[model samples]
Target: MNTDNTLLNAVIGAVATIGLSFLGVSPVIGGAIAAYLEGGESGNGIRIGALSGLIASLPVAVILAAALVFLPLTGDIGVAIGGFVLVFVVVAIGVGFTVALSALGGLIGAYLKENA
Candidate 1:
């Protein structure tokens, strides 16, 4: 694999994620576009999409962690998991969601490009 091209694709994916995010569009679309432009095999798109999704979710992970820090206690000891654990779980899920969606998008785009 060409590391330089892969890195380039990842960078493009990141930029797409950031820009599409501000446009109220799903960042996965950006990942798909980047992977499509990268023009490698399907697996390449998947890898690039995953990278993009992970990077795109960085800000969300930070925001979720910050928000979880100020939890109001409900006096329910049973439901009181450590804030760190909760935050981690939420952020992990968010990352997982992004990765899955971005991967799907990448797969579709690559397929279309290849078949076209």
Candidate 2:
């Protein structure tokens, strides 16, 4: 497989993810497409997929970071702390979901590539 193209493929997949997300499609499809394009082993596919997910989530991470930073400036300390924790948890879960699903999709894509 051409390992050199992995990053490019992942970027394409991230673009796909961003585009399809507007239509309510899952990021898994994007991940699968990336791995399929890479045509590598499962491990490599996972790496590509995870990278894609991470790339796609960059804007989200930035927004979440902003929220975290600014939330503390609002009103009471107790409310701010609570808001911070909630946002943190939401960010963690969202990132985790994207990465995990993308990895699974990569595995599936690799399996498909091997069999087909």
Candidate 3:
């Protein structure tokens, strides 16, 4: 519930994401862990999950977006741009889905902690 705990959990969640990525893992699991550790209300859990996901994915998103720059080297610039836009859309949706799933997990964790 405290701001300090929230920040700590968010940092842990971000680090967990990076570690899990090496094993081709999902961010939702890490988000849940962070939220569970946070141990607040369901709303707080959801907020922590969303925050965690955002933090966790930020660097990867930036790198992937930057990689779009190389698309122009192989073919038509117009097509490349269009393809990049489409891929960007997909990535955005994927990010949203990841955040949503993390929120769900966080809610579950919150409930479990409350019931326990």
Candidate 4:
């Protein structure tokens, strides 16, 4: 992996993460959207979304890490690809974290509602 590619990926990831956060569309929302798109039931959407998001994000992280650690290239081509992959991974991880947090929030909300 080229040092330039690695640095570029990191920069792109940071920018993308910030952008998504500002859009009020975290990974959890993306995950929930994905589940809904797949025809998941409303009752189970949150859980399914969380699981799917987590699973999906792992590959993204791996790919980004691999690009930084394994792929050997230089110049604009490498930078472009690395930037794209890095952004993708950041989005995926954001979605996963959001979904997980949403799930936990739901559970806590439900427990409180029930107990109250």
Candidate 5:
């Protein structure tokens, strides 16, 4: 792929990933939508999702790694399958984390009856 195309794809992927994650949705699904919008090649969609997930999860990974090193696991094995799994795992974790935090905030607000 051309450099420009790759950069554009990555940017598109990153934006979609962040937007979807904020909505408590899957980045991969958002990436797939981005890919379809960019035109077919589901594999490219996967790539975009992976790139997006990597970028989105970087801060979380760093914080978790520093605060809880034992919780952060990293390894390289089975190139194809492993890479795909890693991408999905990152996207899922990011989305789930955001969703869980949002739920917690809601519960706390409800408990405190902040709105009332």
Candidate 6:
């Protein structure tokens, strides 16, 4: 209910996202719930949502990074470079996708909160 606490709201949203993910719900719904609870302007909602998305993505990023790091690399320098590049591209795209979806959800949630 405290709209000023952006970090708290984002954490709550990330929790919601993790929970909803188990139930097959979209992360967008989690972001919307977070921004709705935040109860502020759209910009604030966007911030909260993006932060939440980033927080939620942290675990996935860590796991992916670990996997890439622990992978046994052949002696070929080109293959090692290509592998790292591929991992980087995948992680970047995934984070971007999640953030974009959450931001859109935040916008929608702000509108709904304002209207209601």
Query: Which portions of model 5 miss their true places by more than 4 Å?
Result: 1-4, 37-40, 68-116
Ranking by lDDT: 2, 6, 3, 1, 5, 4
User: What's the best-to-worst order under TM-score?
Assistant: 6, 2, 3, 1, 5, 4
What are the per-residue Cα lDDT tens digits for candidate 1 across 53-81?
A: 77778888888977655654645554455
Report the C-alpha lDDT of model 2 over 1-116, residue by residue, as the tens digit: 43468888888878888888875445788788888888878998898888888887787877987897878788789989999899889888888888777777777777788788
- Reference-based TM-score, model 2: 0.87
For model 4, what is the alpha-carbon lDDT of residue 18? 38
Error of 4 at 43 (Å): 7.3
Worst-scoring 10-residue span by lDDT in model 2:
22-31
- Which number leads on lDDT? 2
Q: Report the C-alpha lDDT of model 5 over 22-115, residue by residue, as the tens digit.
A: 5655455444433443443444444544554555555566554353333234343355456556655775686566434433332332233222
TM-score winner: 6
* lDDT on C-alpha atoms for all candidate structures: 0.72, 0.80, 0.75, 0.46, 0.47, 0.78
Better of 1 and 2 by TM-score: 2
- Over the stretch 73-107, how does candidate 6's per-residue lDDT look in tens digits? 66677787788888889899988877777877777
Which scores greater on lDDT, model 3 or model 4? 3
TM-score of 1: 0.73
lDDT of 4 by residue, 1-116 (tens): 21223223223333333345555544444443333333323444445445544544555566556655433455567776777687667766665575575444333333333344
Evaluated against the true structure, the overall lDDT of model 4 is: 0.46
Q: Give per-model TM-scores.
A: 0.73, 0.87, 0.78, 0.40, 0.43, 0.88
The residue pairs that clash in candidate 6, if any, are: none
Model 2 whole-model lDDT (C-alpha atoms): 0.80
Relative to the unseen true structure, what is the C-alpha lDDT of residue 69 in candidate 3, on a scale of 0 to 100? 81
Q: Give the per-residue lDDT digits (tens) of candidate 3, residues 13-59.
A: 76786678765445767677777888879998888877777777777
Q: Candidate 4: which stretches are off by over 4 Å?
A: 1-75
Give the backbone clash total of model 4. 1
